[model samples]
Target: MRILVSNDDGIFAEGILALIRAVADLGEIVVVAPDQQGSASSHGISLHRRLVPKPVDLQIQNVEAWSFSGTPVDCVKFGVTQFGEQHPFDLMLSGINEGRNLATDVLYSGTIAAAGEAALQGIPALAVSLDGPPFPFDEAAQVVRKMVDRLQFKTLDADTFLSVNIPAESVDGPWVVTRIGAEGYRDRFIRHTDDDGQAYYRYVGDVVRNIEDDDSDITVVNKGCISITPLRYRFTNEPAMDTLKTWF
Candidate 1:
């Protein structure tokens, strides 16, 4: 199986490197990732600027890597399309992101966007993330390795992708299948005054650690279990179709 790896974090991030090392034995691997941090870039592609994939030396044996000056989605797009017929990708692993992407946070996450782009191209993908700082990327990579192995043996549905979140400490329980939480970060704003007495509000958010629903991704990770949420591309609200019809 040929695997395409990418991340929102720059090409040389430790998390991505850890992930690459863990899954090295899987198959032919090629990495195309952002040249700089594009954390909340979502699914944006470079439309105006000329895009290029610069060959990068990750110093990892037998793995070809490149750095792209675009969004994470761009990396996945370049990896899937530009590799020619012989290097068709079977799977994409889009993170080991330094931060968690839970609930609405996925809407803003380039990490999730990379995985989403791969899924859009009919390739099975996984977006892996660590909860907080002091990230144990090696441990998370090992866990992701097992998940990837399972995905390799048992095929994933074409339209689906998995978003995984690991805790800062050791994971205690088994993989808990969960859904995206209803709520996102508990946000706040702090106002600061500049030299000219201009006030600027700084955005601050602490992710809601737990939720009432045990099956929600937010709560699952809080309970010391690795949360695995299967996701698919969807925006149409079929349930609201009837309401719209009545209005018309």
Candidate 2:
């Protein structure tokens, strides 16, 4: 299997590095990741600016790597359009992100977006993430390695991707295929101005879990189980179309 890896946490992030190391031996691995952090960037692409992907010889788990000065999605797009055409890839992998991506968080996750872009291009993709502070990446990598090994890459459907979130607690071994939980933080953002009269705002407060719903990611994580949600690009309102038509 040929695997292309990328991440929103930049090329040198511990999460990406760990993931690359873990999955390097699984197949022919190539990395095209942001030169700097691009978290919460969503599926944003650098449209106005010419993307400059520079190849860097970084020793990641003894594997050679490259870096990019664009969003995570850009990395995947660049890899497919440039390199994959010649060599081809069986799969595309993103992250082992520093934090969990659950519920609506997927809309703002560059890690997930990277995989989404690949799926859009008809590649089997996986976006892996972990909860809380950076943990033992080597250990995490081992877990991911097993999952990658068992994956049936050729059987994946078009425009389909998996959003896998690992719990902070060790899973003892592999993670279960679970659904996205409805529970998540009541996100809050605060606006403020600096003394120099510059307008700036900072996000404040800690995330609160709405784990009352058993099927939500928060509940799953709280139970020490991994969540794997199948995702796609379509955002239809078929159920609400008639209701919305009434309003019109």
Report the lDDT tens digits of candidate 1 across residue range 26-75: 87889999999999999899999988779998887768999999999999
Maximum-TM-score candidate: 1
* Clashing pairs in model 2, backbone N/Cα/C closer than 3 A: 181-216, 181-217, 182-216
Error of 2 at 147 (Å): 0.8
User: Superposing all C-alpha atoms, what RMSD in Å does each candidate have to the true structure?
Assistant: 2.2, 2.4
Off by over 4 Å in 1: 186-202, 206-211
lDDT of 2 by residue, 1-248 (tens): 77889999999888888888787776678889999999999999888987787777767553547788889988998889877998788888898799889877898899999999999998889998887664666676677777777785346779889998887676443466666655445657887889998988787635665544666666676678777788888898798999999999
The positional error of residue 199 in candidate 2, measured at the CA in angstroms, is: 3.8
lDDT of each: 0.88, 0.81
What is the C-alpha local distance difference test score of candidate 1? 0.88
Where's the lowest-lDDT run of ten residues in candidate 2?
Answer: 171-180
